[model samples]
Target: MIEYVARSGPPEAMNCPAFICDACRQQVVGAGIVTWATTIGDGRSRTHSQSPLYVAHKGECGRKVEAMLHAGYPASDGWIDLWDDIGDFLKQLTHNATNAFTDDADGEYHQHRLEGASTNGRMQ
Candidate 1:
Protein backbone atom coordinates (compact mmCIF):
# COMPACT_ATOMS: atom_id res chain seq x y z
CA MET A 1 0.00 0.00 0.00
CA ILE A 2 1.15 3.52 -0.77
CA GLU A 3 1.44 5.67 2.33
CA TYR A 4 0.74 9.37 2.31
CA VAL A 5 2.42 11.95 4.52
CA ALA A 6 0.23 14.51 6.20
CA ARG A 7 1.51 17.96 7.09
CA SER A 8 0.29 20.76 9.28
CA GLY A 9 0.51 24.54 9.93
CA PRO A 10 0.65 27.37 7.40
CA PRO A 11 3.17 27.52 4.60
CA GLU A 12 6.28 29.63 4.77
CA ALA A 13 6.60 32.88 2.87
CA MET A 14 8.75 33.10 -0.24
CA ASN A 15 10.83 35.65 -2.00
CA CYS A 16 9.38 37.74 -4.90
CA PRO A 17 6.01 37.34 -3.25
CA ALA A 18 2.92 38.90 -4.80
CA PHE A 19 0.37 39.71 -2.17
CA ILE A 20 -3.34 39.27 -2.86
CA CYS A 21 -5.35 40.07 0.20
CA ASP A 22 -8.78 41.31 1.28
CA ALA A 23 -7.98 44.61 2.92
CA CYS A 24 -10.47 44.76 5.73
CA ARG A 25 -13.03 47.46 5.12
CA GLN A 26 -14.11 47.64 8.69
CA GLN A 27 -11.05 48.93 10.51
CA VAL A 28 -7.70 50.15 9.32
CA VAL A 29 -6.58 46.51 9.40
CA GLY A 30 -7.59 43.60 7.17
CA ALA A 31 -8.34 40.05 8.22
CA GLY A 32 -8.52 36.53 6.88
CA ILE A 33 -5.44 37.15 4.81
CA VAL A 34 -3.58 34.68 2.56
CA THR A 35 -0.87 36.39 0.54
CA TRP A 36 1.01 34.51 -2.17
CA ALA A 37 1.98 34.21 -5.80
CA THR A 38 3.47 31.57 -8.10
CA THR A 39 5.47 31.30 -11.30
CA ILE A 40 3.32 32.09 -14.28
CA GLY A 41 2.68 29.33 -16.87
CA ASP A 42 5.10 26.94 -15.20
CA GLY A 43 2.84 24.02 -16.16
CA ARG A 44 2.12 23.79 -12.47
CA SER A 45 0.61 25.96 -9.76
CA ARG A 46 1.98 25.88 -6.27
CA THR A 47 0.46 27.40 -3.16
CA HIS A 48 2.61 28.53 -0.31
CA SER A 49 1.27 25.49 1.48
CA GLN A 50 3.04 23.29 -1.08
CA SER A 51 -0.32 22.30 -2.48
CA PRO A 52 -2.15 23.29 -5.63
CA LEU A 53 -2.97 26.98 -5.64
CA TYR A 54 -6.58 26.02 -6.11
CA VAL A 55 -6.78 23.93 -2.98
CA ALA A 56 -10.22 24.02 -1.44
CA HIS A 57 -10.97 26.69 1.13
CA LYS A 58 -11.12 25.70 4.77
CA GLY A 59 -12.95 28.71 6.13
CA GLU A 60 -15.19 31.54 5.02
CA CYS A 61 -12.25 33.87 4.46
CA GLY A 62 -10.21 31.37 2.49
CA ARG A 63 -13.17 30.73 0.23
CA LYS A 64 -13.63 34.43 -0.42
CA VAL A 65 -10.00 34.77 -1.36
CA GLU A 66 -10.48 32.00 -3.90
CA ALA A 67 -13.43 33.75 -5.49
CA MET A 68 -11.57 37.04 -5.79
CA LEU A 69 -8.94 35.17 -7.78
CA HIS A 70 -11.55 33.86 -10.23
CA ALA A 71 -12.72 37.45 -10.86
CA GLY A 72 -9.20 38.48 -11.84
CA TYR A 73 -7.08 41.56 -11.33
CA PRO A 74 -6.07 43.82 -14.19
CA ALA A 75 -2.85 45.75 -14.31
CA SER A 76 -2.90 49.51 -14.47
CA ASP A 77 -0.52 52.49 -14.31
CA GLY A 78 2.11 50.00 -15.45
CA TRP A 79 1.70 48.32 -12.09
CA ILE A 80 0.64 44.72 -11.61
CA ASP A 81 -1.00 45.69 -8.36
CA LEU A 82 -2.92 43.09 -6.31
CA TRP A 83 -2.63 44.65 -2.92
CA ASP A 84 -5.67 45.71 -0.90
CA ASP A 85 -5.84 47.85 2.20
CA ILE A 86 -8.54 49.32 4.37
CA GLY A 87 -6.96 52.42 5.81
CA ASP A 88 -4.65 54.62 3.79
CA PHE A 89 -3.73 51.70 1.54
CA LEU A 90 -7.21 51.51 0.07
CA LYS A 91 -6.26 53.73 -2.82
CA GLN A 92 -3.77 51.24 -4.18
CA LEU A 93 -6.46 48.63 -4.83
CA THR A 94 -9.25 50.84 -6.10
CA HIS A 95 -8.04 50.40 -9.64
CA ASN A 96 -8.86 46.70 -9.55
CA ALA A 97 -12.40 47.12 -8.28
CA THR A 98 -14.30 48.43 -11.27
CA ASN A 99 -16.48 45.47 -12.23
CA ALA A 100 -15.04 43.30 -9.49
CA PHE A 101 -16.66 42.99 -6.14
CA THR A 102 -15.07 45.00 -3.36
CA ASP A 103 -13.49 43.10 -0.51
CA ASP A 104 -16.34 44.30 1.67
CA ALA A 105 -18.98 43.16 -0.75
CA ASP A 106 -21.78 41.01 0.51
CA GLY A 107 -21.25 37.26 0.69
CA GLU A 108 -17.49 37.76 0.57
CA TYR A 109 -17.03 35.94 3.86
CA HIS A 110 -17.39 32.31 4.91
CA GLN A 111 -17.69 30.34 8.13
CA HIS A 112 -14.49 29.06 9.69
CA ARG A 113 -13.93 25.37 10.18
CA LEU A 114 -12.07 23.98 13.15
CA GLU A 115 -9.92 21.56 11.20
CA GLY A 116 -9.95 19.13 8.27
CA ALA A 117 -7.63 20.13 5.46
CA SER A 118 -4.16 18.58 5.72
CA THR A 119 -1.81 18.46 2.75
CA ASN A 120 1.83 19.07 2.00
CA GLY A 121 2.20 21.65 4.79
CA ARG A 122 -0.97 23.71 4.83
CA MET A 123 -4.69 23.54 5.38
CA GLN A 124 -5.19 22.69 1.73
Candidate 2:
Protein backbone atom coordinates (compact mmCIF):
# COMPACT_ATOMS: atom_id res chain seq x y z
CA MET A 1 0.00 0.00 0.00
CA ILE A 2 1.14 3.54 -0.67
CA GLU A 3 0.76 6.35 1.82
CA TYR A 4 1.72 9.97 1.47
CA VAL A 5 3.03 12.22 4.22
CA ALA A 6 3.72 15.92 4.36
CA ARG A 7 6.51 17.36 6.44
CA SER A 8 7.74 20.82 7.30
CA GLY A 9 10.83 22.19 5.54
CA PRO A 10 12.25 21.47 2.09
CA PRO A 11 13.05 18.01 0.88
CA GLU A 12 16.47 16.62 1.65
CA ALA A 13 19.10 16.46 -1.10
CA MET A 14 19.21 12.68 -0.97
CA ASN A 15 15.63 12.50 -2.22
CA CYS A 16 16.71 14.10 -5.54
CA PRO A 17 14.70 17.15 -4.75
CA ALA A 18 12.82 19.19 -7.31
CA PHE A 19 11.60 22.56 -6.13
CA ILE A 20 8.28 22.62 -7.91
CA CYS A 21 4.89 23.12 -6.29
CA ASP A 22 2.74 20.21 -7.33
CA ALA A 23 -0.49 22.09 -6.74
CA CYS A 24 0.34 25.59 -7.93
CA ARG A 25 2.93 24.78 -10.58
CA GLN A 26 5.26 27.35 -9.09
CA GLN A 27 8.86 27.23 -8.04
CA VAL A 28 9.24 26.51 -4.34
CA VAL A 29 11.87 28.48 -2.50
CA GLY A 30 12.17 28.94 1.26
CA ALA A 31 9.94 27.38 3.90
CA GLY A 32 8.19 24.81 1.72
CA ILE A 33 6.44 21.53 2.48
CA VAL A 34 7.46 18.18 1.10
CA THR A 35 5.00 15.45 0.19
CA TRP A 36 6.27 11.96 -0.49
CA ALA A 37 4.65 8.60 -1.00
CA THR A 38 5.81 5.35 0.52
CA THR A 39 4.73 1.87 -0.51
CA ILE A 40 5.01 -0.99 1.93
CA GLY A 41 4.30 -4.64 1.37
CA ASP A 42 1.75 -6.60 3.38
CA GLY A 43 3.75 -9.78 3.85
CA ARG A 44 6.10 -10.69 6.69
CA SER A 45 9.12 -9.98 4.52
CA ARG A 46 8.00 -6.53 3.65
CA THR A 47 9.49 -4.35 0.96
CA HIS A 48 9.34 -0.61 0.73
CA SER A 49 9.35 1.78 -2.19
CA GLN A 50 9.74 5.54 -1.95
CA SER A 51 8.56 7.92 -4.63
CA PRO A 52 10.27 11.19 -5.48
CA LEU A 53 9.16 13.95 -3.16
CA TYR A 54 6.62 16.55 -4.19
CA VAL A 55 7.27 20.09 -2.96
CA ALA A 56 4.74 22.86 -2.62
CA HIS A 57 4.49 26.38 -1.21
CA LYS A 58 3.64 26.39 2.49
CA GLY A 59 0.49 28.45 2.22
CA GLU A 60 -2.51 28.06 -0.09
CA CYS A 61 -0.91 25.69 -2.52
CA GLY A 62 0.22 23.31 0.18
CA ARG A 63 -3.21 23.34 1.73
CA LYS A 64 -4.67 21.94 -1.51
CA VAL A 65 -3.29 18.54 -0.60
CA GLU A 66 -5.13 18.56 2.73
CA ALA A 67 -8.25 19.66 0.95
CA MET A 68 -7.95 17.02 -1.74
CA LEU A 69 -7.69 14.42 1.01
CA HIS A 70 -10.74 15.87 2.75
CA ALA A 71 -12.57 15.62 -0.58
CA GLY A 72 -11.50 11.95 -0.78
CA TYR A 73 -9.89 11.82 -4.21
CA PRO A 74 -7.94 8.60 -3.89
CA ALA A 75 -10.70 6.88 -1.88
CA SER A 76 -8.63 3.81 -1.23
CA ASP A 77 -4.84 4.29 -1.36
CA GLY A 78 -1.80 4.98 -3.56
CA TRP A 79 -0.99 8.25 -5.31
CA ILE A 80 -3.78 10.48 -6.51
CA ASP A 81 -4.61 9.50 -10.07
CA LEU A 82 -4.83 12.67 -12.09
CA TRP A 83 -6.23 10.61 -14.99
CA ASP A 84 -5.89 12.51 -18.28
CA ASP A 85 -7.00 15.89 -17.04
CA ILE A 86 -4.41 17.45 -14.77
CA GLY A 87 -6.02 20.84 -15.17
CA ASP A 88 -9.39 19.58 -14.01
CA PHE A 89 -7.84 17.83 -11.03
CA LEU A 90 -6.06 20.99 -9.99
CA LYS A 91 -9.26 22.94 -10.32
CA GLN A 92 -11.10 20.48 -8.11
CA LEU A 93 -8.31 20.57 -5.55
CA THR A 94 -8.41 24.36 -5.46
CA HIS A 95 -12.17 24.40 -5.16
CA ASN A 96 -12.13 21.89 -2.34
CA ALA A 97 -9.38 23.75 -0.52
CA THR A 98 -11.21 27.03 -0.84
CA ASN A 99 -14.43 25.56 0.55
CA ALA A 100 -12.93 23.32 3.21
CA PHE A 101 -13.25 25.74 6.11
CA THR A 102 -16.66 27.05 5.07
CA ASP A 103 -18.06 23.54 4.68
CA ASP A 104 -16.75 22.57 8.09
CA ALA A 105 -18.09 25.75 9.65
CA ASP A 106 -21.55 25.06 8.24
CA GLY A 107 -21.41 21.38 9.35
CA GLU A 108 -22.15 20.37 5.78
CA TYR A 109 -19.13 18.11 5.64
CA HIS A 110 -20.21 16.08 8.63
CA GLN A 111 -23.79 15.92 7.40
CA HIS A 112 -22.68 14.67 4.03
CA ARG A 113 -20.62 11.93 5.62
CA LEU A 114 -23.48 10.86 7.86
CA GLU A 115 -25.85 10.67 4.91
CA GLY A 116 -23.39 8.62 2.94
CA ALA A 117 -22.69 6.24 5.79
CA SER A 118 -26.38 5.68 6.45
CA THR A 119 -27.09 5.01 2.81
CA ASN A 120 -24.12 2.78 2.14
CA GLY A 121 -20.76 2.28 3.84
CA ARG A 122 -19.11 2.35 0.43
CA MET A 123 -18.13 4.98 -2.07
CA GLN A 124 -20.88 5.43 -4.61
Task: Using TM-score, give the best candidate's number.
Answer: 2
Number of residue pairs clashing in candidate 1, backbone atoms closer than 3 angstroms, sequence gap of 3 or more or interchain = 2
lDDT for each residue of candidate 2 in 7-95, tens digit (9 for 90 to 100)? 45555433333456667766565566665444444434544433333455767876774454335434355434222123443566678
- Tens digit per residue, CA lDDT, model 1, 1-124: 0122243456843333232323222211243333322222222342111112221122565555555443342223111213222332335445556545456566343322222234543322
User: What value of lDDT does candidate 2 attain over all alpha carbons?
Assistant: 0.45
Q: How many clashes (backbone N, Cα, C below 3 Å) per candidate? A: 2, 0
For each of the candidates, the C-alpha root-mean-square deviation to the true structure, in angstroms, is 17.5, 16.3
Q: Return the TM-score for candidate 2, rounded to 2 decimals.
A: 0.35
Pick the lDDT winner: 2
